[model samples]
Target: MTHPMALPVVRTLNTDRHRVALQVFMVVVVAHWAEHLAQAVQIYVLGMPTSEARGVLGLPFPWLVHSEWMHYGYALVMMVGLILLRPGFVGKARTWWTAALLIQVWHHFEHLLLLLQALVGTNIASRPVPTSLLQLALPRVELHLFYNAIVFIPMVVAMIKHGKPSDEELAAAPCRCAPAKV
Candidate 1:
């Protein structure tokens, strides 16, 4: 008897699932730090600090943090949400080194927005100035790049090797579903 060649093989990570969860958890914990995550959102949305700072550029700085526990709680929730959703680009690496490079580059772009605020004040006008033109850029830029590599590397490697699940696989997992038509 001949067997079918195209049977769907369910691929699961044999290792490092716990590691992925831990790394994601750390991001959630650190995201509560005002400078790291909260401030990033505040600046991106309203162009100012969240700690009762005066507004800028016709936007009121979110004073939400002044309430203590609530702000960090919300930030933690947001961080978890961010990691649960696949960022999509991490899977395209042709090689491990390439994946590392892409992860660093993506992080640099993401962090650059914050650096602009740190050095030249949180003004939209600073967006145009090249980094070389600035008197100061954020300290430890390389460290941030490295950290992002560590966080994204495993996930990217897994994605490159395993690939994403199809709609049928996802829909069928632990749930009843109508059979697909041949």
Candidate 2:
């Protein structure tokens, strides 16, 4: 018998509910991507200075760009969301989802390190800013863009695969991502 606590979680991740949850998660992920892309365009395409190139929401709340808490919170959300939605995936979708989850886990760790440094008042490499390890090689903005890209690509692939699952995958899936017969 399923544990009482697990029953709700299992139900949430099953069939139609899982698909709806995934859709909501994907919308959030895409919105974040749009923000990052907007920031990048402001920097490269529009020739705006980095400080002035804050994305849509960042333009209104510029402090968000420098807020380690905000960054860490988003990272944590991504990690948790990926994990929670993972059980709904099967076969190739599961593989791709796992890949995204693994990358997001590392991304979360980097943000966590940055958050800890911020709390302790010691930035990485004695730099003035909170620095991720990769930030040493690339600017923070560019580094995040790369990280998001890598995570997003596999996630998109996973969604595509989920939509047109193999017969075995469809059989294994508790959710209905596949199309119905005419």
Candidate 3:
């Protein structure tokens, strides 16, 4: 005869697993959305006129856009599997969370430079803005900064919440694949 307590313990564990999965999903989706929007604005709205051309930041524009989506998709799907299939990842959630924030920070800077060029470059001056992306009268530079602060800031906060660990806590965590005794 088992104790009645066993079922509640099982339910709590399952609940935690679901919560972690959702958190991971949100991180990936948000990252992909930002990258896609940035790419679309530059390529379709700015009218640089060629997908093969380099972006203002000197990146091959279409390649950057395509690669960003592919990378995000791969990471999101793999992370979901890791959370569900692998027990160790849950315990090591901090590492995964930090990695997500780091990737976003890199992307934030990349887009920042592109926005700067779009607002001021003579090359862009000749190209008429598309009605679909944004009105020409709006300040593109300010808009970019505002979006960076509003959208990416939350992602950074979530990453720090999920990933950070005290020095002592990290020290106590066992090293991967402990050496076998002779």
Candidate 4:
């Protein structure tokens, strides 16, 4: 028998509500990716200075790149979103979603470490600013772009698989990501 407290949690994660929530979360994720991509284009394509290459929203909030809190918050959200929506995925979609979740977990850890260092008034490898572990090899902006790309690829794959699930997968899904039966 399910515990009373667990019942709501199960229902939240196992209903059509979860699918809608996942779709909304993915829109936010894509927006973030666009920001990163825009930033990259500003630097590499437009020849803008790194400091001046703030993307769309960054034009007004140029300090976003310097804010550990913002980075950590995004990482945390991605992790939580992936975990919360995972129960609704099944079969191939589940596998791809798990892949994205695993990568995001690692990405979250990197941001966590960076945030901790910033909070402690220290920096990775004694750099002047907060730095992720991978930042030692790649600059922070580029590293984040790489991280987002890797995570997003699998996420997109999962969404595709979810939308056109196999018959068995459709049967297992608690939500209607698959097309309705005629």
Question: Who wins the lDDT comparison?
Answer: 2
RMSD of each: 13.6, 2.1, 13.0, 2.2
Candidate 3, position 86, lDDT: 26
> What's model 4's overall lDDT?
0.87
In order, candidate lDDTs are: 0.38, 0.88, 0.42, 0.87
Off by over 4 Å in 4: 1-10
* Candidate achieving higher TM-score, 3 or 4: 4
lDDT (Cα, tens digit) per residue for candidate 4, span 1-182: 85422567756765757667877998999899999999999999999998899888889887887788998999999998888788788898889999999999999999999999989998877898878888888987889899998999999999999889888888888887678766
lDDT of 3 by residue, 123-155 (tens): 344554311123244454334334445444554
Per-residue lDDT tens digits for candidate 2, residues 1-182, read 86422667755765558888888898989988998999999999999999899899998899988889998999998998898888788999999999999999999999999999999999889999778898889998899999999999999999999889888898888788678534
Tell me the TM-score of model 3. 0.28
Worst 10 residues of 3 by lDDT: 173-182
Best by TM-score: 2
Off by over 4 Å in 2: 1-7
What lDDT tens digits, residue by residue, belong to model 1 across residues 84-115?
A: 33221232322442444445344444445444
Off by over 4 Å in 3: 1-14, 50-182
